[model samples]
Target: MSTRPPFTLYGSNASPYSCKMRALMRYRRLHFTWVPLNPMEMASHPNPNIRALKAKVIPVLEWPDGRVLNDSTVIIDALEAEFRDGRTVVPPAGPARFLAKLLEDFFDEWLMKAMFNRRWSSEVDRDWSGRWIISDQLMSAPELVTLPSPSQTSGLIKFFRDRQVGRLALVGCEDDKLWQHVMYEVVGALDMQLRSGDACRFLLGPHPTCADFALFGVLKQLSLDHTAGRFIQDHFDAAYGWVLAMDDLSGLETDVDWKSLHMDTPAVKKILKLISAMYMPYLVANGKATRGEWVEVEFHLDDGQTFRHKEKFGPYQKKCLDDLKRHYEQLTAS
Candidate 1:
C-alpha cells in the first residue's frame, strides 16, 4: 500500500556489510525488497545494475530512480544525506563524528579479521556456522536447514571453508591467538565504555550512530556464528547487549532532538590509544608499501602481546586512512 517504489537490495546473509545496510535501511523505515543471492548468483544477476557492482561485493542498493550504490559505508552516507529530514545514524558533533567514523573503520577493516578467524579457523565452527548459512541462505529448501549430509552440503562447505580460511592470512592474523588478542582489545574496551558513568546504551549515546551500526554488522554475525557467538556470550555481556540493542529500531524518530554528544572520555581515549598504537602503525606501513616499497609493521597491544606483518600498500585501507584524516581536518576547520 506504500506509494514509493520498492528499493532493490542484493546481498547474502553471511555478509556483514549486507547486514549493516539492511539494518540501517530497516531502522530508517525505508521500504526495500531484499534479494538474497549467493556470490555466484549475485554476479550472474541479469539486472545490469546488480552486475555492475563496483567492489563486486554484496549489499548493493539500487535506488528507485535507477541509481546503483555499492559499499555499505557509501550507501549509508548517501542515505543520510538524502534523508536529512529523517532520523540519522551519524552523530552531529565534530569530535564524536570523527570518533564514530574512526571506530567504524576500526570495526569494518581491522576487527573483521577476528570475525573471519572465528568463522573459518576451526572445523567445529565451520561445521556449525557454515551449515546454517548454507542451508538458510544458499539453498532453496528451508526444511534442510539442520541436515548435515545433504549431497550439496560438502561442496558448499569446501567452497566456503577454503575461501574463508585462505583469507585468514590476508587479515594479518595467521594465528588464532593473535585473532583473540584483537578481539579482547575490542570487546574489553567497549565493555568498559558501557559500564562508564553516563551508561550510554549505544556507543555514542542513546541513539544508534554510524559507529554502532558499523560494529553491529560484525557483532550480529558474531552473535549468530557459533564460535564468536559463544565467545561474546561467555565474556562480553555488555557487548552482546549492545549488539541486541542495535538490532532494535523501534522508537528512533526523525523529529527527535539530536544530542550534542562528544567523544572525550576515558573509554574513547582507551579505544583511540589502542587504534593509534596498533592499527595506525599498520596502516602507515601499508601506506608506505602502497608507494611501491615493501614494508613490515609490528603491532604491540596493551596486554604486552606483539605481532608483525609484512604488507604491500592496500588501496582500500589507504583510502580509509585518507578519508579519516580529511574528515578530522574538516571537523577542526568547521
Candidate 2:
C-alpha cells in the first residue's frame, strides 16, 4: 500500500479545470476523494478550510493536513514536487519543459474562449449545460445520488444560463464567428499532431504532459457539448479520441527518455504560429493594461482584425506572462 496521504478535491463535474486536476491526480495515481461542489456556494462552504479560500473556484484541493490550494496549474506543480513518481506531467527540463508550459497556458487562456463560447452561445447548449451543471451539483449531495427534479432546479438553471450567457463579451467570446474559426483550426491542428505517429499521441511525446492535461480540460467540454462535439466528431477524429484517452491514464506508463522527445512536428509548428498571432498579442495587451499603459486591452490579430476588451484586465494573466518570460530568460543557450 502507498504511504501517501489521501487528498480531498472539491470540484464540480461541469468545471474544466476541475476535470483537469482530477485527471492529473488520476494519472499520478494519487489517492484522493472527489467532492463535487457548486462554485456559487463555495464561499459559504461548510468546511472552514474551503470557506477560507481567497478565490471561490472549483477544483480546490485540500491536503490531508487541512491546507487548501486552488489554481489547477499551481496544484499540478505542487503535486509534481510532492510526488517523485515517474508519472510526471512536466517534461524533462529544457526547451521541452518550456514549450509544455507555453502550450498549457495557451490552451488555458485562449482555447478556453472557444469552449465557453460553444457552451453558452447556443440555445441548445446553454439549456443542456445549465440543466446538467445544476443537476451535477444537486446530485453531489451524499443523500441525493439521483437527478433532481426540474421543478427543484428550474429557477436556478435559468439564472445560471442567463448569467453565463450575459458574460460572453466579458470573456471575449462574443464573436461567435471568430471563436468558431479558432475551434476548427485548433482541433484540426491537434488532429494532425495526434495522427503524426505513435510517439505524437501526446503533445510532446509518447507520454502526456501538463500541456496535454490543459488541452484536455478545454477539449473535454468541446467533445461533450452538443454543437462543438458534433463538429469535432465530424471533422477531427483523432483529437476527439485523444480527449477520451486523457480522461484516465492511471495504467499508462512509459520510459522517461527525455532525449527522444521532440516538439518540431508540423502540428506543433502550426499551433505555435497561431499562438504568436493570437494569444501572444492578447497577453501583451493584457500586460500593458495591467501596468496602466491602457484603459483596456486592444490588440490586432494576424487576420488584420483588431480585438478589444474593456472589461477588467486579468492580473493573473499578466502574472502568467511575466512568469513565462522569467522562465525563458532562465534558459541557457545551448
Candidate 3:
C-alpha cells in the first residue's frame, strides 16, 4: 500500500489525453483517485485550482499538496521524477529515448488530426459521441443517482457537437482526404511493427514507453468511434489489439535490458520516414509562421502534396518543435 497521500486526477472519458494519463498512472502504480469532470464545466469549476489553471484542459493532476499540473506530457514527466517505481514510460537516455519523444510528439500533434476528423465529421459519429460525452459528464455528478435523461442533456450535447465541428478546420481536420491517408499509413506501419515479433509488441521495444502511451491517447478514441473503429477492426487487427493491451498494464513486469531498446526495425524506420515527410515539414513551417503575423500555415510534404491550414499559427506546436530540435542536438556519438 502507498504510504503517501493519494493524488487526484481530474479528467473526462471523452478526452483521449485524459485516458492516456489515467493509463500511465495505473501502469506506474501511483496512488491516485480518478475524478471525472465535465469538460464544459472546467472553466467555472467549483475547485479554485481547476479554475485557476492557465489552460482549462482535462487530466489535471492535483498533487498531494494541492498544486495543480496540466498537459499529459508534462504531467507524465513530473510523475516520473516523483515516483521511484521500476516501471517507467520513458526509455534510458540515448537515441532510443529521443526517438521515443519524437514518436510521442508526432502522435500528439499530427495523428490527433485523424482522431478529431473522424469523431466530429459524420452525422452518426457526431450524434453518438456528443450524446455519450454529455451523458458521461452527467453520470459523474456527485448527486446523480441514475443515468441522466436525454431531456436533461440534449441541448448541451448539441452545443458541444456543433462547437467541435465548427473548430475542425482550425485543427486541419477539414481535409479529410489528407488525414485519412495519413491515418491509414500510420496504422498500417504500427500493425506491421506489432506483428513482427513478441519483441516488437510495444513501439520502442518489449516494454511500453511514452511513445506507446502517446499513440494510445489518439488511437484510444479511434478505436471507440464509429468510422475509425470500423477501419481498425476491419483492416488493422494487430493495432486494434495493441490498443486494448495498452489500456491497463498495471500488472506488467519489465525485466528487459535497457541497452536492447532500439528504433531500427523496418516498421519503425517506415514510421520515422513518414514523420520526416509529414510532421517535420509542418513543424518547420509552423515555427516560421508563428514568429510572424501569418494568416495560414502552408507546407509541402515529401510526396509532392501540400497542406494548408487557414487557422492562426500554433505557438505550442512551435515550442514542441523547438524542444525536439534541442533534444536532437544534445545527443552525442556513443
**Candidate 2 lDDT score at position 271:** 86
Query: How would you encode candidate 1's per-residue C-alpha lDDT over 1-334 as one tens digit per residue?
Result: 1257878887877888888888877777777888776666656677887777756777789999989888888988898878774468776656677888888898888777778878888889878766788776645433354555678577986787777777666555466887777777777877888877877666666567777778888888878888789888898898888778767574455443455455654556676787888788977777666564555777776668787765445688889888988888989998
For each candidate in the order shown, give its overall lDDT on alpha carbons: 0.75, 0.81, 0.82
Give the Cα error of residue 333 in candidate 1, in Å.
2.5
| Model 2 per-residue lDDT at 75 | 92
Which ranges of candidate 1 are over 4 A from the true structure? 1-3, 140-149, 196-198, 253-259, 291-295
What's the TM for model 3?
Answer: 0.92
Model 2: per-residue Cα lDDT over 209-288, one tens digit each: 89889888999988878888988998898899888988998878765566766788666788898788778877887887
What's the residue-level lDDT of 29 in candidate 1?
74
Candidate 3 residue lDDT tens string, 206-299: 7888888888988998998888999899999989998898888888877646676767865678888778877887788778884434446565
> For model 1, which pairs clash?
290-313
Cα deviation at 5, candidate 2, in Å, is 2.8
lDDT of 1 at 282: 78
> TM-scores across all candidates?
0.89, 0.92, 0.92
Give me candidate 1's TM-score against the actual structure.
Answer: 0.89
